[model samples]
Target: MQRSAAISLTCLISTAVLIKSSPPEVGFTLANSVQIMALSPGDPNSYSRPDLAVVTHTNLKLSVDFDAKILRGWATLYVKKCGITDELILDHKGLNISSILNDADDTALQYVLGEAVEYGEKLSIKLPQSESSNNTYKIRIHYETSPNASALQWLQPEQTAGGDYPFLFSQCQAIHARSMVPCQDTPSVKSTYSAEIKAPANLTVLMSALREEVIESDGATNTYKFNQPVPIPIYLLAIAVGKLESRQVGPRTHVWAEAEFIEQSAYEFAETETMLKTAEDICGPYVWGIYDLLILPPSFPFGGMENPCLTFVTPTVLAGDRSLAGVVAHEISHSWTGNLVTNANFEHFWLNEGFTMFVERKIDGRMFGDKFRDFSAIAGLNSLKEAIATIGENNQLTNLVPSLIGVNPDDAFSVVPYEKGHTFLYYIEHLLGGPQVFEPFLKSYLDKFKYKSIVTSTWKEYLYEYFHDKVEVLNTIDWETWLYKPGMPPAIPAYDNALIETCKHLTKQWLQWDENTSCPFNKSDITNLTSNQRIEFLDELLLADEILSQKKLETLNEKYDFDTIKNCEIRFRWLRLCLKGRWRAKVTPALTFVTELGRMKYVRPIFRDVYAWEEVRQQAIDTFLANKDKMMYVSAYTVAKDLHLDING
Candidate 1:
């Protein structure tokens, strides 16, 4: 029942022959290998010239020198000429290049390292003229990553929990991969890779790939090898080395963290197998052979990076109640949505994030309930509206397909693509009658675009083509406003109000808590509600616009005591509300709380608000200056931008 590559070729060739008498078509055909002429336009943010030659695979051998704070490595890239001349350009940032050689002939190759730009320096390698379009060559470059490599965060032994050895990890998304490894540094180009990492024997190494038992350290150092059979985008490339260990939490899933955190890490992510199974039963089989979770240090930037096999997650998700496991579900959902089918460019990033959000909620719905899904969606809806307003409704970044040309991709990162994209898909499901009616289209969409990157145009085309005669339903969609217009979508998808109505009622009561003499909601009331309900209540209060009034904050905090909340999500928001409300007492604890965890989801917004408090501006500055080193590059870069501080090492 599966359509193999050969059948695909035959079908395309047959169609082409049939259309030959009519007109010249725009595509090509079948054989032992089908030539992919229509590669995704690729990321504009990258310095690499992928149009000239495409990288097929990469081999990385690096040694982590903790004392020197560097990763010295040589990268071997195998590239194929795309019916072009003999020159290849790669993206490199702050890398010390020693030499370049032709792997085919083992001879020196002439190269040029261009001036550094916003993304990186362009490394151009001259190669022998191509014998044909299929001509392939290997270029090996000897290099060492700069100490200030943005993607890599090197931590001293004292900086980590173990305090016995140094820690190093990579956050390569959004063009940072170029700083660590020279390549296209774009999500559009996926290359299967193998990594041989040498590190201190006292540490364990893990990457976004399969791993085997490491022989006990021989002496001062140990070597770890990883192989990713599936081709993955550069952004998905990741690695971590520290006093790490793992424990099997599911049939096909494992959790990795430092020895002290391993047990709790396993418990938090124990439902990964269930999530994977539910997702497969909903969409299709999970393609990635094994699913594993790795808990990075508190400052691991984002909530989770959905690296193909190994997902890098933040330590904040370990709330002891598993209330934050939704993040794990989100990452697992990416295995199907992002890893399998990627967005061709950051301009149309919603295809990756949006679909993942949709599938993630679907899996969560099955695991918990429809109420849970709608509740989460409602919270996300608030965030989307806030993001749009924050960016200014007229800003193009609020669009489903934002323009990334001549702009850094990182600046456009927001919840618009995520929530808006989900809204669009949910709208389509409604148009087609329901999810059941639209289920096949979802599966087929994944099947058609599996292991490939695509732009919005391709997605729209395939969607229309799938519906065939019934494509008329799509005609109802205002594609232009929904896809291009700033602000919000033309229409809002209907959410089950049943779940949020109670949460909304409680929020309203709290908003008037200062005016009311008696309140039905007490500390027991807080305990009675779900963790997500607590989040919803706090999120609603943030919109009261009367946050500057300390009277209300004192009354609320006195009764509920949000300062001691265990749920990180609720606790962070409450602390933020205190700052926004000018609750002077909150400034100290807020400073302390921000230092405790560096998860952007919790800390970035706190810094942004506290920085604006004016009263505690210097306090905020001093705290960030003190702890910025503890933050990940992505989070630190963002905070620095918010505070207009230079990126400090």
Candidate 2:
């Protein structure tokens, strides 16, 4: 759970090295290692206390400086309470709190310094002897302090010349909001917020809730006013103010990014308006005001975060010239799915991710066409298959299901939520039909659940209500099987069909290696494929082909006389298939292909057998090197070792 703008990533790599003789033991049990140490065993709800929130007045006003990192100011809160002498507690991490006063200054309020408990510097306050209930009175507190690294931190980039970056930002989701502002930092407590943030003269300050007004600066500082009238979870509250560049998309939508990333951000996020309009066309009006995208600097982790008005994205999305529109669609869809109809706990994270992913698939399919739709669908299915593979034959990983799936929100971080959940929803959409068919149902769900917290069971129940007897297909499909009992979907004819179709048409053709069998006279069957088609084919064939059939594949391998110079992709594919099958006789030829391919500078970084390309590159390099000395591809040994050093170390 990253806090909004309150933390920095630090790598603690060490020089010490250790080699294991065998694979280490691991488990699938869901563990809350961090939370267990963070909270007291007897006081599980101590960190969450909404009962302490007492309203003296219906309205409150406050102002503070973000430069200090610590929120120090006085809040004049009017209250009415009815408990003779009990202290009230406010959500504050730490501070040098000086005075607590009332409107009359008649000393109606008293200050009883409460016991300060600091779990990574979160300071809790104690209210004085005053019946906070049913009393209309004024309360004020003066404060000053420094930034808490344990809670929040900031980066003042070097672009501001001699001055420090005036803009302030926050990483408030998941529990860090308390490090920035004083509040009942829990998902249940919703209150109106009016903040006056002071920043450098020209820099802008954007917030999580909504913008009320902005007061121009007198050449030194500016005062921005925000009125958050909606009841929102504390984690959803965010603040990102910086020297950003902004551009309008369609009518009211805007794209704001770091000054350095404006042009690319604009181009990559070009589809923002289209996506927004499509979402609105499906679900009623856009509930959140103008939608915006913020491209954070490179080090920012996570592909994107769905804040109310703003979506914070990692600059890494700028790769390969705007191919990241899928992520943009994902975030934008969150405006309705995750933000409007939120999940009460991380356990129901599927409600946020699964639904948002469903929206993204629809938007991508509509905007980019069937090719993208097909690619994305297959990609999702492939990822789910991989997840099952990692779990293994004993069903060890699958057995950890209910406990690991959503029990501890953090457990849902992997492709399990994004890919498996997506596949599940994709299956749902397959049955429900496309946009024209499911629009009404989607809109109805959003309309009914807006601003409310929900869980998976509630979602499932609501879905049943919407579908009713008209959709008996739901009865045959068990949603719980996908969530609790996991493994790859049962081996059915469809799975084999997909495997065969993907292998036959999508993969590169293999060469015949047999010295005895009659070979085909024509070469057009091999020459007809495009480079991309060839690579795609190679991937499927190598991944799916069984090891026992390597002898037959090898016979076909030799007929083509595989040569890296003329067919790098096919040669590499043959080499990879040989390695995967672990066919001892084919090692010589696989080695030959690897060596020749390694010399080519234009090959994909993965095929180069060096670099972080997780799949092909690493396996290719490791295989060739192991067989280098005795195989026909002996020259590949040195290249593999060198590449491995560069990549692994």
Candidate 3:
């Protein structure tokens, strides 16, 4: 679940330490004397009572209705009663439940739908007395999702690349899963799932699982069956149906996209196998069997969603040069950090994002070099600063483990967790020995907590236990400031500036250029720079004390031809610079970029910059109003907040 907006800002640092002997391989079992608690202390955002009874498995039978833009079907949940409770609780939003049947006997079950709250409505169903001797029970819920399900983004034919068939995709991370399924919508509870989805015969259907078989029910529709043997949080439960085609990219990988972008996607993600192998070398064996990629439409919000076997990626990454493929590495690393070892709740989100960022850079370093890894970390640090400034330095949301009670996790999403978490891990790596010492601990940690959800405290305790010999050095770290403090990190690691120095020098030259001085820059000045280096140079300019003048920007575009660049990352930074300088010519280009793709990372900031310019504020609002219906729920919701526009209107 890597956010595309923060992809460019990812950072990493590595070091080495001396050890007395080889670190012993730890087993999956925890010590009985440690008194481990439940997966979480009850997620505040969920209404489910996992403490009493929890769903262990979910079997879905749903039919897609593109005309009505809804999914009507039944979910049969296999539950395990943990306490002497007479009811089963689940989380649901905008779903109409028709009936609840006790699968043991063909009898109806009484249920209550609680009032809607900030998160969602609480669904409580009276449990039928079990006739079996075991504690497990099966309850079937027949329901239909609303046309406006926040988790689903229903696209018309015009919104898709092919413009021949409609598309449907789901984004259920954080808490939106409840809108689509009747289950405990929290990462603390994981369940194995199998789905039978019926959609138009012409459209292809895919989920976050291995495809068993597809049956042609009739000439009009087909039933796509998928089975996920691995138990995963409901958030990882994904489904997409559209005019899709697949091309075999690797032994266990396939790149799925529309006919228009299929070839480009296959080429862009050709290194997915290399990334998976590199991640395995750094972390551990890949638990999920297959690692396929689904190149989603431009309206896909995030950079990538690590949905178990199938990773959902934004079309913005098809930069033709494959320079942006590192995002796949981030999602691949999540196979262990996030999907394998889950975050107990959104408060401990850093455990998922920060660890993934650390591992992603490890893959980068292994694939490229240590210097490139450090350069990425430096870029991440700049992004962290920008995030803190955007979300006020003193705001508690900037904390690594901020209290998410009553706060929408969507609103709290930022680079703090991704970059700050990576910074903390890197700091610890430097303090202890380097990768030689810490990398072993990472594998051990994954082995200890794989397939389980945990909090920050559990991770910290394990960290202390792993490096018992370095407890004295660990004691020197200020846990309070690092975990709870809001602003910049307490200390920045000594990153190798050998690579970024060139970007800095170029940035300085551009900042110092003026009408009094002859144009000192040319296209050759940047010809040797990598795509990431050019991005770093642009990032530095954005953070400068004063925005570059329009004349200088014109010179930049003329010299570098940034206006014609196909790379989204470079285009994003260039547009922001132009908008900040109040270059009216780029305003239409910026608007087109925002409307064409719904990646929040690029859209939100550009919209904010446009809104800041009084002359275009109304124009920005109008453009958003016209396109809000096409944007993903999270993207539209957050962008509306940035524009101060009423979403209902």
Candidate 4:
């Protein structure tokens, strides 16, 4: 039941298309698979992709009304079960399976559903009673689809960031695909799938998995039939349907984007072939075929998502010419780590994200040289730190071993998985000296565990069993200090002094939430920072803590006041920072800034989207005027409704 979930840096969690029925009537403790062991079957696969999935979807038809956000479909699935079992457990999260027909007759003897869990556009139904002991069974399912609830939604009529065409999109990494469809939505339940979607003919549909065929024309609607044979976890399944265009670079290499953004996506992804080829060279081969990209309608939220062959990237990558090669490299490397070998559960999500992130640096260095690669690492660390702080909890390096699937599933997953995972791998690589030594070990690990479920312990065991001489390398490094601790480790010479300074400054500003102060600025050294530096300071100030003091906040706002008419990024940052710094105070200065920002119409969506900005601003003002005596300080206890917005309050 997965629509499409990729491990993004902000949400570093693996996803599955699982079917839950009747709330734990039947739960799979662990899903195990067996592969022919040429040598260490328990070690890992030698980088060969799973090549045997024979489920075919045909005559696949779908109808979607964007306004309603609902999808209805009927399809014929031909399954040559091989040895998979008689009753095949297909993923069907969120969708109601109206009927199941075998051949041309209704042969579904009976179906057993475990617990039904709703998430995004997917729904998971655990079927404990579908006869599958037999070698094969012909089956078909009728279903309806809808928009994923977890998606970052926007008013439909709104234009893209560039103000061209209106569009909508979703991010499905971690375990949110249950909101999209229902099925055995776990990585261990790998299967082949095909899809045919009906969409507005004017719009283009981009998908992540493989596409053996497609049929399109300028009519009332278009039919996209994708024939995929690769055995992939449900999370990698994806589709992006909207008015768009594409350009082909080479055999199996293409770029997609809205007409208005065609040039940008093409330009930014120009080096895609090189990146894909480089990754294949290092990781063995491209199992899912060639690489393609989709530059979605604005509001993609994250940089990129590695969905099998198609990597979905935000339009923001088009900002600074074609300098987005780093992101492309990261997503492409996922073809090996995240896409090929995946994490078994959300808690071990770092297995997918961290490995991909680390391999990205290696690929970038090989393709774009060392300087660009180094920058990518620094950026990864910065972004990871920001994600950890948002949760307002300690980010211990050792905690990466805990399972996310059992711990509320919601709070258990985080950027720490990817960020910390990558950091750990980077440390491992550093300990191993260079790629010459590490590449074989990585290849050997993949060779052993491909198509199998893995966790931190599995990885540790493999490391010890294969490289016993270097096993002490793990002991030397303090994994606990990194994963279980609240802050980053001390500076290593691997990064430049500038990067270290950036981490220190950002970390200090972020930790300020625990260390409150009247004025959060480092007034002593504000003069020498660059424009980017100043913006970073302001961003952290707003995000780190709640606005509590009315008078002191107003005075601080005045102290950092800037010319109201300027278009400087700093001006935008100042308005946003002040509003966040004093929303609790609900003072005149904060209210005035909110009104001015609205009137100026120059606010970034990130700020304007602040939870109930309009309502909260007015409420603060009314509350202050009405109850100035008894309640002097604005309350930081945000009702649950307000948490939906960026602000926790």
Q: Global lDDT of each model?
A: 0.78, 0.52, 0.87, 0.52
lDDT digits (tens) for residues 475-571 of candidate 2: 6676557665556543211222332354465233333323256644344544654443344555566456444256555554554455432444355
How do the residues 368-468 of candidate 4 rate in per-residue lDDT, one tens digit apiece? 56665665566566656655555554533225544222223434444566666777776777687767888888888876765444556667778878878
Pairs that clash in candidate 1: none
Stretches of candidate 3 off by over 4 Å are 1-41
Off by over 4 Å in 4: 1-61, 75-93, 112-134, 147-170, 216-219, 249-252, 367-372, 395-398, 405-413, 451-453, 477-494, 498-649
Q: Which candidate tops TM-score?
A: 3
Question: What global local distance difference test value does model 4 have?
Answer: 0.52
TM-score of 1: 0.91
How high is each candidate's TM-score?
0.91, 0.63, 0.93, 0.67
Candidate 2: list runs displaced more than 4 Å. 1-46, 51-153, 159-168, 188-192, 216-218, 319-321, 385-412, 431-438, 470-473, 486-649
lDDT of 3 by residue, 1-649 (tens): 2211111111100000011111212342454112112112356567777767778778999999999999999999887666678998888898989999998787999999987755778899998875644567889999999999999999999999999899999999989999998888887776688999999999999999999999999899999999987778889999999999999999989999999999999999999999999988988898788999999989999999999999999999999999999999999999999998888778789999999999999999999999999999999999999989989999988999886655689999988999999999999999998999999999999998777777787799999999999999999999999998788889899999899999999999888777567887889999999999999999999998888888999999999999999999999999999998899999999999999999999999999999999998998999999999999999999999899877865
Indicate the worst ten consecutive residues by lDDT in candidate 4.
Answer: 630-639
Cα RMSD to the true fold for all candidates: 6.6, 12.7, 8.4, 10.4
Ranking by TM-score: 3, 1, 4, 2
Model 3's C-alpha root-mean-square deviation from the true structure amounts to: 8.4
Cα displacement (angstroms), candidate 4, residue 238, comes to 0.7
List candidate 1 stretches off by more than 4 Å: 1-42, 129-133, 212-218, 515-520
Kindly give the stretch of ten consecutive residues in candidate 3 with the minimal lDDT sum.
Answer: 11-20
